[model samples]
Target: MFIDASTNSLTVSHRPTNAPSGLIESLKQYPTANVGDAMDRLNLMDTGIASQWANGRCVGPALTVLTREGDNLAIHRALDDAEPGDVLVINALGGTTRAVFGDLLAEICLAKGIAGVIIDGLTRDRAAIKELGLPVWARGVSPAGPAKYGPGAVSVPVACGGTVVNPGDLITADDDGVAVIPVERAQSVLSRLADIDKFEEDLRVRIRNSAVHAAAPAMASTN
Candidate 1:
């Protein structure tokens, strides 16, 4: 996504995953597109890690999972320790040969009130995942299943979708893609987002007015 699934060890590191007070609420008001704009496009996951369902959006602190190439035992372990509103961000090493997640895991996340998932590798059960309405962004899907062996770590920084995601980073994802904001920088990012919002709103007004202006001459000539 490997080291052979047969040879992988397990490591777990627990750390604080809480974002700044009001940070989640502030972030919820913006989309990943706008957030990316605010960050000068430096904060986004790669375009390939896209939403598994239409209209899926999520904002929460990440609970990072670093797994051996083709195994997901660490993902299961991460789920056991997840807090409400945590987004399980797994670095599966980009191996798409097997699907490391599916509907059952989606169900578990939903039941546990976890925010969503982002995988650097692949997943399965596209239809069922959509049916459950769990927000997921992954490289793609595979019908093949994953190995459930240890040799993975939870709450540690790992690479995902061409970026390194640290545990407790604010993960904002949508149909457009995913963005990871370090918790320490979230409030600053929020302020920047407001400036971007204003700028975009002004641009949108101008864009719409230009459309109306462009159509007027045609309407006048037709009349």
Candidate 2:
């Protein structure tokens, strides 16, 4: 429920239900690098979305929002509708002069159990967000605030950071970058990521044992 200050009344509405199961938790088991590798093997491109921070990781289904530049009412609406395992994916037309979100919003997301936030625009209060442990993947930061008015849509498809994101699509982000997996392909992608992780682990072991070096003479000769 939201308050209509103009009328001094409380407004109530139904919250949108989130996707039941996308194996969100399972996807969290693999880092974004492994997921990216799996996407490559599947002939998928445009999965990477750059992150402003290098330490935080997020995994969840997307709750997409598209808002006009310098306005954030749609982001608030999305926050209200987002479930515990939902990632707020906002497309602000790549606006950078004004911030679409900040630490106060991060606090609300934390309290609401939101998995994370990915914005194709700027955010503020970066230090506070990191201290609060809210995973945010954004392009830049600005001290400028936003206007509340919005002519935007929620739970709709949005282009974020050069990638098309649809509501309920599985999203994962880490130090490497962000990756989106179609909802229907989430399970298959998860399996493939696991295989990739295993193969990489084996390769790492072989490298540590000097086997890879022994098999490549030119590389050994350089050393």
Quote the lDDT for 185 in model 2.
78
Error of 2 at 38 (Å): 1.0
Which of the numbered candidates is closest to the native, going by highest TM-score? Answer: 1
- Per-residue lDDT value at 184 in model 2: 76
TM-score for all models, in order of appearance: 0.91, 0.83
lDDT of 2 by residue, 1-223 (tens): 1412121121223434544554777787898767878777332223334565657888888888888887777777767776887888888888979998988888889988988898888899988898899888877899999887777788877788777887888888887777888877778888998888888899899888797667689787889
What value of lDDT does candidate 2 attain over all alpha carbons? 0.77
Q: What is the lDDT for 206 in model 1?
A: 100
After superposing candidate 1 on the true structure, give the runs of residues whose Cα lies further than 4 Å from its correct spot.
1-8, 213-223
TM-score, cand. 2? 0.83
Model 1 C-alpha lDDT per residue in residues 1-223, reported as the tens digit of each score: 1123442467878768498648897899999988887778887889989888899888999999988767788888788788889999999999879988988888888888888999999999999999988999999998998888767898899889988789899999988899988888888889999999999899999999999999999999998
The per-model lDDT (C-alpha) reads: 0.87, 0.77
lDDT of 1: 0.87
The stretch of ten residues in a row with the least summed lDDT in candidate 2 is: 3-12
